[model samples]
Target: MKITPELVEHVALLSRLELTEEQKAQFSRELSKIFEYVEQLGEVDVSGVEPTAHPLPQKNKFRPDEVVPGLANETALANAPETEDVYFKVPQVL
Candidate 1:
């Protein structure tokens, strides 16, 4: 889990970043700490816990769909700035 300056430079290159030597060294130290912490977390006991996609209960919040009468063509086109018969009129597209 060591984060060397070379590793930092490689990641910087992948991320399209231009880091100075000082920044690379700084990031190397910081990333090492982060990886070390993650490694430590991996040692904690979670054998009794069940795997879950989310920690909280989830439910679909939508109302049931019901057969409903659709708007009439005249009602739909009533507010349009421009219309041709029952259809909306717009500027011609190429």
Candidate 2:
């Protein structure tokens, strides 16, 4: 899992990135360190460990859904300059 300059170059090409030689060298070192840390993590024992999707616990709050009185049609359409039967009318586009 060692990240070399060639691997970094290939990955940069795949991601459509224009990286300089210095950037490629820096990324190679950083990515290699990350891979080494991940390899170390693979050595940890977790035979009876439970897999979790989230690190923290979560719960959903619930409330009753009910219909409430809303604005009248006349009051709703009062601000509009154009109104057909009981709805606002706008210019039609072809």
Candidate 3:
């Protein structure tokens, strides 16, 4: 699929983006190249390849989770510019 200015403009409108004329042209070219690459990928033969949800084996991929003591409240609040009652104090929001 060839990317055109009208297509780019339509996408921009849908995405609520304001693109300059040059940017629109650039995006059109870039999008066209991506589509061409996808077309090339479509030409490859993968008839004998097995379908997989992931490339690596799923079992034993991560280390076992261990319970660790968290930092004390006083240590966690040591570097606060503004704190009140063990909590960070920020400006009031309306």
Off by over 4 Å in 1: 44-94
Clash totals, every prediction: 0, 0, 0
TM-score of each: 0.46, 0.46, 0.44
Models ranked on lDDT: 1, 2, 3
Better candidate by lDDT, 2 or 3: 2
Best by lDDT: 1
Candidate 3: which stretches are off by over 4 Å?
A: 44-94
- Regions of candidate 2 where Cα sits further than 4 Å from its true position: 13-16, 59-94
Give the higher-TM-score candidate: 1 or 3.
Answer: 1
Model 1 lDDT per residue over 15-54, tens place: 9999999999999999999998889878879999888998
